[model samples]
Target: MRSRIIFFVALIAILVGGYGIYDSVLKNKDKSSVVVNEIAPQPKKDSVEYITVWRTLNNIDRGESIANDALKREQMLLTDALDEGLRSDVELDFSPSTLFNRDLPQGALILPEYITRENDPGYIDLLVTEGMTLYPLVVSNKNLISDFIRPGERIDILTVSSPSSNLSGAIEKPIRFKGVTATLFLQNIKVLNMGGEDSEQKLKPVAGKSEDGFTTIIIEIPPTEVARLALAQRTMHLEVYRSREYEEPVYADVRNVMSNYIGIEEMRGSKNKNGREGEL
Candidate 1:
């Protein structure tokens, strides 16, 4: 009877131990389910912001330059910049007083790429206009103010040459056309240099060649006008007259030289003992 009682007690202890194990397992399962249902924590958002930048004050037209007064400062969120490529006032190192390379509407951001600098070729190139070219004219004392002419001075150019070979088929006649007549060539052209001032070796007057030696002056002329200049210089003597009016261009193209400049023909073709053309 004692053995029977012990066996019954063992069975009851086993049942209690099994129930305790089952309850612990169920508790752990419930905790895992609760963790799975909870939402994931989001990454912290960036809070730092606010950037101040310069914007155009008015409508900046294409090819129009920007002045200091053309800009105004405004604040924007740093986090919301247009892109990583957008330039900020801090990143740019240029003067506000620069020409805009392209059109910028009013209230537009002043981009660094929109302005031109002195180092750029386009900056220096702007001094020359369309359909125009810079040509260097070699000059001498033929200009009354040759010694006094400077780079920025304006002057008039005249040509004295023999007219078209009226003596046709007169070749083998021992000589070509005799340059004598004078005409108005170019007017009011800007002179870039005088008396070889920009060169290391200064030009000295040619003693026995012509009355004055050769000195070169630079001039700007249109393409259409260039042919006239070349024709004059190729077969004629070129002389300069100072422009009286500084602000206006003057042109006088007269075909009749005998009426205007009397006795010039007789003065042009005289010769020295060396048979060289005499100085005017």
Candidate 2:
């Protein structure tokens, strides 16, 4: 009986020691797993690849030449910049001969599809940019228009009108005066087509004067100014002034026209009253 009890005790002690060793091993394994998880770096959810590309610094109009300072380099996400015709080069140079084919908003990515070359077919027709209107005007003053006028040149429009009384048959005011007035109608108007053909294709180069005895020019102007231009053309004679440099916008200034009117009045007054053909 003693031997059997000793045997049972020894068996119980062996089972307890084995169980303790297994528990310690399990605890150690759990600790190692937690340490590994804490040390491993986690990936960021917002991580992405980016590339540097060219973007417009300001809103660029169609058919406008790209200036060197007009473009800026910016970093954009790769997914956002992955267009087939996208201009991806950070060091790419814009050519002076190329022009924007469509209007681009500020910060727009430059692309090959957005540009047109000067030698392209129907280039003159493409000079009218978006939000602009083309107007055809008949001009008879050859002395004002130069022979070198061509598309892409800027010109100013003016009107000459004979003075009429503002009073509609009312009692004439004491200081009432009638004279001629020359007014500036429009400024910085762009020429698109001249003489029914591209200026480059003309053989004789007779601009502003042709066999028809009048010149028809197609010009580009703002949409809002179309009605004003039409009214000016219908009311009085229109003339063009080509300047070597652009001038600031100045609406009808009657002072300059009045000076000419005074000169004419002085000449008429200097003549003998009996020799005067009619009333002044």
Candidate 3:
């Protein structure tokens, strides 16, 4: 009877151990068969903010007038363009006289600081208007009041020459007078520049030659009058007289060589060139 009891207990212990191993196997199989659906993160989209700015299409030099075709428009991020001092299409001045103040490489952004207007100090060619020609009138430094005259001022040009008359028409015999006569050559002319004032030495006297030093007064004139002005400048002495804006040109002539005197004689004993007493 004891032996039967021992065998029955052994069988029960074996069945229990086998059942535990089977249960573990079933749990592992169930865990392995289950599927895990994972969701991945997506990338962020770009910002919708942007701005339109001007850019150069080719290399531009300093003091050069920028043409419309030489520039290009592009859309850029507002945050990036604002810090660069760039100009937009509408904000830029497209006048014919507008010029670049600094050299710009190809594909460079067009900035406001690089621009120069008519009032800026630089070369004056960019300041000339369309359909007008720039002519340089060379005058002696002693004759011109350069301190009073400035660019953009209006002035009348006077020519002083000895009067001449044709005695014989066929022979073209001319008789010239000793006294000099002055006449208005050009009136209400616009002064574009006073040359040789630039610190960079880019602007020099228009006529490279002068006897007692000279200053080139650049003026704007019509194409029709260029020939006359050029001829007069070469043949006679030119003088400048400041005039008002929109002032009608007046016919003026100066023939007197000396001022009428009402003065006293010198107190000291001084001999004049003509062997007479010197008078003041």
Question: Which candidate has the top score in TM-score?
Answer: 2
Q: Give the whole-model CA lDDT for all candidates, comma-separated.
A: 0.59, 0.66, 0.66
lDDT of 3 by residue, 167-255 (tens): 21112222333344666878889876676555333223233233467677888998999999887776666777786544554443322
Give a tens-digit lDDT track for model 2, residues 1-280.
9999999999999999999999999999999999988966777798777777778999998778767799887787777777534435455436554678788999887875677766677555566766788899767644345556665677778776545533211233424345545567787787765645542553123355532356667788898998877776665566776644436554443456466756655555554657763335
User: What is the C-alpha lDDT profile of model 1 across 111-168, one tens digit per residue?
Assistant: 6677775456575344344566878776544344434555456778766554643321
TM-scores, all models, native as reference = 0.37, 0.44, 0.42
- Cα error, residue 275 of model 1, in Å, equals 26
Model 1 off-target regions past 4 Å? Answer: 1-120, 141-147, 164-179, 193-212, 245-280
What lDDT is reached at residue 162 by model 3?
50
- Report backbone clashes per prediction: 2, 0, 0
